[model samples]
Target chain A: MTGNIFYFLTFLTLIAAVGVVVSKNPVYSVLFMILTFFALTGHYILLNAQFVAAVNFIVYMGAIMVLFLFVIMFLNMREDTEQHKPMLSKIAAAIAGGMLFVIIIAALKDVDTNVYHPAVFDSQIGLVENLGIVLFRDYLLPFELASILLLAAMAGAVMLGKREPGERNRF
Target chain B: MELSVLLIKALIIVAVFGVTLLIATYSTYAERKVAAFIQDRVGPNRAGPMGLLQPLADAVKLFFKEEFVPANANKFLFIAGPSLAMLTACMSSAVIPFGNTLYINGEYIPVQAIEVNIGILYIFGVVALGVYGIMIGGWASNNKFSLLGAIRAASQNISYELAMGMSIIALLVLSGSLSLRVMAEQQGQDLFGISGMNWNIFYQPLGFLIFLVCAFAETNRVPFDLPECETELVGGYHTEYSSMGMGLYLFAEYVNIFVASAVMATLYFGGYNFPFMYDLGLPHNVVTILGTVVLFVKILLFIFFFMWVRWTLPRFRYDQLMNLGWKILIPLSILNVVLTAGAILLKDEFFK
Candidate 1:
């Protein structure tokens, strides 16, 4: 049952990821991206990484994607309004995409699929308590550093978004 | 994971679904009755005994009404919108524990749909997704007012969700768990010699206040109903929706209210844990049944409070809503988290 579910979710994720790229309307692309996130969350759940699954659902599918949709909706993107690219540019894009795909395939070729043996796997490792201990104990510095990076990015965004004292409403 | 266990979980899920829909159906009647009482009117007395069957009548009316799709609206999304809203609204109830464990044939079965460890986070994720239905509906309508309403909803929900999450952080710190069932179980402790009265409301009042305010905003209740404020935005996101599409959107609001009330009761008011619950020498099963009743009472009271506030309070302006969410609630909830952490530290250092 679990294996079937995993395969199904993987198929869904692939389809939705392709949909995100190929959808002409930006809103449709955003919706497809959300579906991709949902499928990835299903995969996380299948792996018994419930904490990671919930966080993925909340942060990526919930918060970030909503902002993406919000911005795309404001842009008023429609299929009829789309500008067609030149034939040369389309070929160039295809070549760029194929090269990136080949690079990913080559990088993943040596990955050891046998590393995650079901017999030796610790299902409890993905649980919240165990993950929390691992994070706070062994990976404390990296986690804190990541948080600081997020904080710096947030501060930069605020600084950039703020208007000057004498500025008028541009719109 | 036995077949019997699976069957019992399925039963509970169906039961919870039925009860949620039933309550949401009646809440419309209750809201109108409550509004009438507040405004010195009789309110729907003709449907049945004090409008008992009013909601049923309303449901029939809604079903029989003309289903409308705007001329220029995106047909697929216009249909998908309310379906998504209703879907996410119902999804959150699965994580809530309605009562204590039931002992049947010497097996312990929790009175909940599912018992995932990340229960609270699951609900949060579902609630966040609820905004998508409104956004899609409004944008699909291709109406300026509907689009504006969707924008308001998206921004309001995002802004308030931060404070709501911050407020919940304080509760999580106190309870030391993300599972709503665990939180409810933790509150089943004795406090000040009173049995089963150690509610988190006493410990995290500030957090509860912030949470209540944000809940209003997140659910798009009164004083924060700028998204669908009839005066400024017509029917808001549902302006172009009609018949069952509009009905689903409206019904979803009531379901969301019901879920929010249940969460608040479970988190702060000692869900199914009334004072003297264990002190009475009642039979175990009887106590469990009584506890479920008590939990529903608390939930209904909170629902009534939702309606009471809806009628009593005036709506906030758009800018004021933004200011309150960003400038006040966020900072206050952060303070609540700091206070909770400090208290926890002090208790560990000195009280222990």
Candidate 2:
């Protein structure tokens, strides 16, 4: 039954992912992407990665997608202006995607056949405390570095986004 | 083996949803009455004996009103937007513990919908996703006003959410638990045998204050409600919504306010814990009911406070709102976290 549920979610996720590209309206495409992310969050829950599921919901569904939707809405692009790529380029892109998928599956198959799993699926691992312990204790340096990266990103964004006193001429 | 447990759980879910809907329905009337009183107007007293039936009449009117869709609007998304808003608003209530637990025939059933370990995170996640409803609805309206409203909501959400999360982090540092149930239990430690002083409010006063201000902003309530202010963006995000679509947006705001209030009560107001609750030594079922009542009282007080502020304060200007959210509240909340951590490290001596 759980496997069937997983398959259903996977099917929906894939459909939504495809819809993200196929949708003519940018608004609809952003919504489809949000739907895909939600389905992925469900997958995280099924894997007993509750913290990951929550983070995915907060980050993907909450913050990032909000900005995407905002920009799409702010631009309010009409469907008439869509720039369709050449058919040959689309075919080539699909072929490249298929190759990448095959490569990933092949790599995973070898891991399933050979490399022993070290991470046990203990439900406790999904609790916030344990996740914090691992992130702060085990990955402290990397976490700090990631935060520093965010700080720099924020600084750059502020600098670039701020309107100059002389910039009103453009508007 | 336990059909009764499943039945009870189902009943609780339905009950919680029903109660929330009922509360949100009446909140409209409450908001109007409070506004009228504040403004020295007579208020909606015509519906039925002091406007007791005002919400019912208002709801009926909304249902009977024209359901509109703009000529150029995206059909599917226009409909999905309000429904999504209402859905996410109700979804956040699932993980909240209304009370402790009720016992029957040697079985214990928790009052909450689901006792997920990551209860707080679950709520934060759901509440964060709620912006999409406004964004989608506003954009689908295809009006410039709607677009502006959606933009304001997106920006306001980004600004206030950070401070809100920071404030919660301060509470978590002191409470030492992410699960709402455990946090409530931890706060059961009476302060010198005093009842409510044992609450987190006594310890993390600054965090509670920051959380309160952010809560106002998050709900898009007055003093921070630049998003939908009539003088500015013209109905904000719901500028083009009519009938039940507009109704859902208004209803969802009340539900969000209720959820935020319940969270505040649960976190800092000792949840369902009453002063000298343990001293009562009451029976299990009795205690559960009492706790639930206490929790409701806290929720109602916060709701009243929300309404009172909405009536009393003028909406902030856009730049002022952003400045308050980003510059003032964020830094203060961060400072709160630092102070809380320092106090925790220095032991009881810091407070003494």
Candidate 3:
């Protein structure tokens, strides 16, 4: 049953990933991205990473995707209004994506499958206790660095987002 | 699990689903009746026995109304909006521990749906996903008013969720567990060495206050409901939604309220732990049933409080809503976490 569910989720995730690129409307693309995230969450659950699954659902589908949808809607975009890219640029973009995909596959091919094999995936690894210990004890410096980076990004956002007196009242 | 065990689990799931629907249904009537009573008028008295059947009538009316699809709206997304809203509204109920264990045929059955060790995180995650309902619904309506409502809802929910998470951090410090079941058990101790309920509300009143305020914002209730303000936004996010589509949005709010009330009660009020419950000298099954009733009473009280504040308080302006969430509640909740951590450390150093 679990294996069947995992395969089904994987199929759905792949389908949604294609849909994200294939859909014409930006809103539809966002919705497809959300579907893909849900499918990924299902895979996380199958691996007994319930905490990761839930957080992934909450952060991506709940918070970030909602903001994405907000921007798409606020712009009131239409398919007719889209500017077509040059054929050469489109071909180049596809090539770039393909190269990145091949690079990822080649890099990961040499890695041991046992790293993520279900049989080797300890159920306790996803528990908040164990995850917290590993994060704080073993990976404290990297975790703190990530936090510092996020703080800097947040400051940058506020600086850009704040309205200047001369730029106010345009509406 | 045996066939009978699976069957029992299935039955409980159905019961919980039905009860949640029933509660949501009656709450609409209760909100009106409460509003009328507050405003010095008879509310929904023409239906059946002081409008006891008003919600059923309302539901029938909603179903019969014309299902509208805006000419410019995204068809699939317009349909999906309400379905997602209602789905997430009811999803969090699975993690709530309704009562103690029931002894049936010499086997123990816990009065809860699936028990994930990260029960609290599960609830938070589901609650977070609920934002998509309003966001999608408003955006799909193809109306500027609806778009504004969606923006307000997204921003409000995101801001308030921070405070809510921080407030719960205090509870985690106090209980040292992420499971709601464990937190409830920790709060079930005797009050001051006597046979009384030891509720967490007494210890984490500041956190509770922050949680309560954030819950209102998260659910888009009064005093923070800028998204659906009638005067400014004209039904807010559901302006273009009609028929059962609109009905689903409204119904989801009631369900969210019921679930939020249940959460607040379980976290602070000792859940199903009644004061001196062991003193009753009842059978195990009977005690569990009584415990469930106690939890229900607490939930109902919280629901009433929600409605009371809704009718009594005025809505905040958009800026005010953001300011309250980002400035006041978040900072206060963070301070609460700091204080709770200090208290825990002091206890460990001195008492423990």
Candidate 4:
């Protein structure tokens, strides 16, 4: 039963990911991307990682995707209003994407697939209590440092967004 | 046994779904009645027996009305908007424990749909998704006012969610669990020599206040209801929506209110836990049933409070709404967390 669900979710994820790129309207693309996140969240739940699944659902599908939709709506993007891309950039983009795909396939070819077999599953690792202990006890320094990095980024954003004393024009 | 357990779970799920819809339906009638009471007028009295059947009447009217879609609107998304809102609104109730375990044929069954450990987080995720319905509806309308309403909703929901989560973190620290069931059960214990009187509200009043305010904003209730403030944005996101599309959006708001009320009761009001509960020496099943009734009473009172505030308060300007959410509520909730942590530490050190 679980295996069937996993396969179904994987199919959905892949289809939605492709849709995100192939959709003509920017709003449709954003909606497709949210579907992709939802499928990923389903995968996480199938793995018994409810904490990760809920966070992924909230942060990616809820907050980030809503903002993406917000911006896309504000732009009033339509297929007819879309700008024609230069042929040179299109070929360059295709080449870049193909290269990344090739690199991913090469990297995964060396991995031992047996580790991911259902027989070796460790459900406890994905639990919130266990994750909390690992972060605060074993990986405390790295976790704190990561938070500090986020804090610095927030400060940078505030600094950039703040208006000057004599500014009259609003962006 | 396993089959029976599955059947019981299915039964609970259906029951909860029915009850949520029923309460939400009545809440619409109650809201109008309360509004009329506050305004010194009779409300919906022409319906069956003092408007007892008003929601049914309203639903019939909505169903018979013409289905509408604007010429320029994105038809698929326009249809999906209110459906998504209703879907997310209904989904959050799965995690709320309505009562203590029910005993049937020597099996103990929890009175909730799903007993997941990350129940609170699941509710948060669903609540977060609730904004999508409004945003999609507004954007799909292809009107400038509708787009503005959608934008306002997105920002308002995002801003309030931060403080809501922060306030919840304070409660999580005290309870030491992410599950609403666990939190509710923890609050059932004795406090200050009164059995089943140990509510979180006694300890986390400030956190509760912040959460209450944020809930108002998150649900887009007045005075934080800038998104659909008809004075400014016509019908807001559902401007182009008609018939059941508009009905679903309105119905979804009541469902959201009901769920929020339940969450508040479960978290801080000692859900399904009544004072002197054990002193009566009642049978276990009887106590559980009574507790369930108490929980629903608490939920109804909260719903009434939501309407009460709606009629009493004036709508905030968009800038003032942002200021209250980002500047006042966020800082206050953060301070609540810090204070809760400090109090916990001090009690551990001195009292122990």
**Native contacts kept, each candidate:** 0.88, 0.88, 0.85, 0.88
Residue B295 in model 2: lDDT: 94
Candidate 3's residue-wise lDDT over B160-244, tens digit each?
9989999999999888888888887777788866443889999999999999998898888888888998898898899998899
User: What CAPRI grade goes to candidate 4?
Assistant: high
**Chain B TM-score of predicted candidate 3 relative to the true chain B:** 0.98
What TM-score would every model get versus the actual structure?
Answer: 0.98, 0.94, 0.96, 0.98
On the 0 to 100 scale, the lDDT of residue B203 in model 1 is 97
Instruction: Compute the lDDT of residue A119 as modeled in candidate 4.
Output: 75
Candidate 1: TM-score of chain A is 0.94
What CAPRI grade goes to candidate 2? high
Residue pairs with backbone atoms closer than 3 Å in model 1 (clashes): none
Per-residue CA lDDT of candidate 3, range A83-145, in tens?
A: 899999999999999999999999999998666677775777877788889999999999999
- Best-first order by DockQ: 1, 4, 2, 3
DockQ of each: 0.91, 0.82, 0.77, 0.91
Model 3 vs. true fold: TM = 0.96
Q: Is candidate 2 or candidate 3 better by TM-score?
A: 3
Candidate 3 global CA lDDT score: 0.89
Looking at model 3 chain B, which ten-residue stretch has the lowest summed lDDT?
A: B187-196
Summed over model 2, clashes come to 0
lDDT of 4 by residue, B171-274 (tens): 99999999888999898899987878999999999999999999999999999989997989997888888899999999999999999999999999999999
Each model's C-alpha lDDT?
Answer: 0.93, 0.88, 0.89, 0.93
Looking at model 3 chain A, which ten-residue stretch has the lowest summed lDDT?
A113-122
Higher-ranked by TM-score: 1 or 2: 1
